[model samples]
Target: MEALKKLFVEFLQAPTQENFLKVRNAVLATEEFDPYTDAIDGVPKMMEAGELEQALEVMKHALFPNLVLSPGAHLNIAFLLHKLGREKDAAFEHHISQLLQEAIEETGDGTEARPYLVTRTSDEYDYLFAHDLEAKGQALAKSPDGTREHDVLTTKDGGQIWFDVTDIRKVLARRMESDGEASE
Candidate 1:
């Protein structure tokens, strides 16, 4: 995990496709990687409680240690920093968020045939939020041969978007298998 952490830092420093691939591969190979959770999970509640500083601290601490490749965490941190009057830091985080987002967008267009690739479900919402859209519904889908998985989102404006969430699917599958083994 420490080596994976270093890879993530390196990728943040040089956010290119090659660096991202390294991080992605490392994440996928690790059984402990859970794309469903992040340190920033508590931020919204903290914000609602007016504990901005605490929320920011939680986000920073969890940013790297956790498998949080989603842009939403950075965006949340940026928003918190901006609210705290740290424009420079906020801008930097916002930039990082955009870089991560661009990496996902470059994977494919948001169509069923060519869905945008994302590591976490939060990223699907981030992509929609970035486009000023809202999801009216969501469903999991698979390729015709059942080799690939996707998240098909129906937009409020009666449109649809797609995300290739294969990594997340794999993570969930592994977790389910482990749970079954534990129960037995």
Candidate 2:
């Protein structure tokens, strides 16, 4: 666990884009992820290192157990994989998207990489746009729009779900850091 933490921190600390990608690939090979705690910590840490691809791969892999990767992971891998031009694989993943959606509803938590599963009843764009706003500081009006923006996880139908970083930041800002730490 500590090694995984160190790997993530190292990935975050590197200065060059070259080294960052290298470390990211290395971390993906490590095959260690804990969603509730470690995987959650690792994602931002990887992004901090500019290893979004690696972080996604690691998280997607962590989301599965056998059959190379799970259905949800395949969907997530498909999304990212498409960005990387892995179309055939992505098309293959399309088949499993519904199963992934079912698993997500069963879990009731949008922690999985990609959980959206659309049906004839609901449109994907509708589900996607619903979460375009964030709620912070007060009332769940909408999310931020600038650099502080975060995405809302959704289903294929586009129903918005998952953590919103904008709100997390507000809560953290209001929190006291430590016993001896100042509140400034």
Candidate 3:
């Protein structure tokens, strides 16, 4: 298993189309491997297939910029960024990764998916705030007219839809915020 993991890292170092295929197959075949590893393999393979957008989406969703790649995500994201013609951003990610590595070593904590709420989608960063998330079923529908109720909304494509409350965590939990921080 350790050797296989090393093989994956080596694939990252010099990911040819062939290597990408090999790693992609290995990730899909192995149940014990991390989902992020599967994502790492999928990204580059998809890129080599000329699917750049799909590759970028995977890299962004994994927060790969913040991880150490030779293990997978780190290196793949770097390569993908370079392929995307974002060299400066790639370099910045590498620099930030070094800092992230230092933090990891000092804290000795493994990666955790810390959910951040989408505060706003600006041109640059999609601003997010830390929030708790829980899953529910699609029933407690919210009305578009401001009042919460069970209702169906019609789409422009001549489709009808009923909102699912349990599916979307509409419960807004309050967190104390300093006014000074919000203004900034």
Candidate 4:
């Protein structure tokens, strides 16, 4: 993960598209970077238990190892920092999250032919959340060639958005295959 760490450091120092893209590429290159499972899974529980500092520590562990390259992690970090009254740091993390969101948006237009590319399923919710939208339902779909997979989210406002989840599917498939092999 040294490559990811280097790219992440560069992105943090410059916050430029070039550096951010490098980090994104590195993250998408592997199935190991899971923002939800690695960084965010325990956050809500911690928050509900009134453990804000512990939540921040969880994020720190995820971020220090470059295990999360998701806007969701930064957004959570921002919220925790804000709760801790670290306004300046919170603002910085919030800004970084926004930048990461913009980078994700630049990947596609949310159309079936050009669906928004996401490394994790939660990113679909993050995109909807960022836009003040709510998903009423979701379905998995495939391209005509059956090569690309997408998550189609039906919005509360009677609209639909599509997220290209081909890579995520591949990762899940790999996990399932490994599980089957291990069981056998």
Candidate 5:
């Protein structure tokens, strides 16, 4: 997150086309990157071409997981979801977009050196999960003992959404292991 904040600050300070392309290319070089091949990289164009389902699938799966670090990407997804009559999904993406926008705004007018903070509080996670369940008109309940302790959210229809923090740690561990293997 601090990396993203720094990137945004650098872009703001320079504000050149070349700088923009450089930043964009850096993002695209990430392992999770996927090209927006349909219609010049704009979601609106995909919608205009009657590819709403494809657009939604790409935004939800491919883009959201990878591009959540980008405010513009969130905004684009939100706009596309709204146009496709998915108001709840749009609202969630808009919330994320606003959060990213606030992070950028807190960087102080693009003039001075500002400390970028990447603090993830429990409240933020609670808010995200709560809003998601509410958007689906489902109630959230705690799972009983003997189940996966990380299974935090259970819906009224017996569906579960597990948000295990250890999962992230494992992913990082795997990445580090792979990186070490590559360097060897």
Candidate 6:
């Protein structure tokens, strides 16, 4: 656990893409390394190869040390759990994802590598956009000239721009739809 914490801090100290890759490589090279990246990478490949059990195992063993990586893993794990007809487990994963989202929103300035925290709705949306996790059905209202109209939400933390409750709903809906299709 200490080594894992060290690695986590090192990654946070320099959160750049290049630095992340470097640290990831180092972790992979270490004999004591948890197979976090391997598991994350193998999931899609295993799924594509119809190795459902293997994919599920990979997701189940994934370790998340921070919110930076937790949200995506939680989302993926939730989907996989649902695919396996484990509705309760999937819901737990989704709840974890929501909690991680909230944590990210409340986190302070991150390391020099990734300094910005998604403390506001606009920032969170931007983070999702960058990660290709944008809420699918929550289209922003656009003007005739194509500029989006900003909708603000005030939370106890501060003012968040372009906040939409539908974003959260869409995320839940996506998981539900995936399960629904699997059930059918």
> What lDDT does each candidate get?
0.84, 0.41, 0.39, 0.80, 0.48, 0.49
Pairing residues by index, what is the TM-score of model 4? Answer: 0.86
- Per residue, candidate 5 scores C-alpha lDDT tens digits across 13-96 of 665444444454454444433332232255567788988877776766544224544565667678778988989989978876
- Measured against the true structure, the TM-scores of the candidates, in listed sequence, are 0.88, 0.30, 0.32, 0.86, 0.40, 0.42
Which parts of model 4 have CA positions greater than 4 angstroms off?
A: 12-21, 35-39, 64-67
Top candidate when judged by TM-score against the true structure: 1
Q: How many backbone clashes does every candidate have?
A: 0, 9, 5, 0, 0, 1
Query: Better model by lDDT, 2 or 3?
Result: 2
Report how far residue 117 has shifted in candidate 4, in Å: 0.8
lDDT of 4 by residue, 1-184 (tens): 7777777878778876677667766776655654336545788999999899999998878774343556777899999999999999999889888877887788788989889877678778889989999999999999999999999999999998999988777767776787799899
lDDT-superior candidate, 1 or 6: 1
lDDT of 2 at 78: 67
lDDT of 5 at 51: 87
Better of 5 and 6 by TM-score: 6
- Candidate 6, position 94, lDDT: 80
Show where candidate 6 strays beyond 4 Å. Answer: 2-38, 64-69, 108-126, 129-184
In the range 77-121, model 1's lDDT, one tens digit per residue, is 899999999999999889888988888888889998899888778
lDDT, residue 63, model 1 = 62
Maximum-lDDT candidate: 1
lDDT of 5: 0.48
The weakest ten consecutive residues by lDDT in model 2 span 115-124
Q: Which sequence of candidate numbers ranks them by TM-score, best first?
A: 1, 4, 6, 5, 3, 2
Candidate 3 local distance difference test against the native: 0.39
How big is the positional error of residue 36 in model 4, measured in Å on the Cα after superposition? 5.7
lDDT: worst 10-residue window of model 1: 61-70
Off by over 4 Å in 3: 1-41, 64-74, 108-184
- Put down candidate 2 lDDT per residue, 1-184, tens digits, no spaces: 3454454345335424443334333433433321112432466567577675896677565542122213344455566667667789777665455433333244324332432222111122222333343332221223334534234443545445533234233333443343226544
